[model samples]
Target: MSLVDLIARADERGLAASGLACLDRCVPLLGGDDEVLRPLWSSLADGGADGDAWGERLAKARAELDCADPSADTVPGFGPDPAPGSGSGAETETEAETEAAVSDEDRAAALARRMLATAPGDPGASALRAWADACSAAALQIHRLLDVAADGDGPLVAAERRRQVAVLELLAGRGAGGLRPALEVSTEGRRVLRAVVSRRARGRS
Candidate 1:
């Protein structure tokens, strides 16, 4: 089923997980460790997104990511290490590299913060629906921003859509156990994003 269809059928908890999982997968782009969002995942165990546990876990994630500042939308340093003998002029290159890193980090942090903001604990249908829609848009936007391909309408977006669908389907078919498979798919996407960053960095060099 399509992502839209899967989301429509998903309960409140499923919807939250779907969105959270997407953000969690992209943590790599923000220089976050793989297990950073694991606490949030644990809260979803009982098909619930409410109570102190969710809030505490969310706060921990924000702290761990050093994203405690809601206004912290800056992207940290990203891209490949500078190559030797590139002769791009070290001083100028350093300034350019700094700009690139900040830009990427700012954008990435903003996207992740937005995703976190959308998380609602056991929301009603209306709230859940709105959150789901936001998640879809955010997920697509996140992919677009991180994508190395210049074309706005490119294969990257298509692939992200497919992955979203696959994640939702896995949730539908396997319930709680689906989180593992869905996360695996997300890990693959993270690798792709990392590669894109490396490629862009190489091009700059």
Candidate 2:
């Protein structure tokens, strides 16, 4: 089934996992360490019996990532492009392009941070579904922005899509048992994103 269909059919746990997986992979952009989200994952594994656990863990995660205030950040929009001749000469144009690229990366990171910041503390099914859908979009956009190759979808984007699909499929077919393997898929994606982030940082140096 398509990723959309899978998400629509998913239960609360599946939706939570789906959204968390997306955010987890993008954690590199937030300067988060690998284990930062483990508490949330463990809460899901336990079926969220203790509702307070999820909320407390979420608060801790937010504090650690320093994304505690969602309202402080503005959601980005596709504003009009700069007018022609905004910069003159070839060197000026190159600098402009580089600045644009960095701006895109900054926007991408902001999107990822927004995903985390806006995640509901006591997520109901409706909230989880919305978050999952938004995370999917933000994660894909993050990969696309960071992808050095401007080719259609790019390898990074294509792999991210596949991983999202695989995660949902695993949850659909295996239930809670799928969380481990789904997490594994997310881990691989996280590594890829970290490398990309590191490469870009080195390039900027």
lDDT of each: 0.70, 0.87
**Model 2 per-residue lDDT at 36:** 99
lDDT of 1: 0.70
* Candidate 2 TM-score over all chains jointly: 0.86
Model 1, TM vs. native: 0.72
Residue-by-residue lDDT tens digits, candidate 1, 43-73: 7775456657877787777777766654433
How does residue 93 of candidate 2 score in lDDT?
65
Clashing pairs in 1: 74-105, 74-106, 75-105, 75-106, 76-105
Return the TM-score for each candidate structure. 0.72, 0.86
Best by lDDT: 2
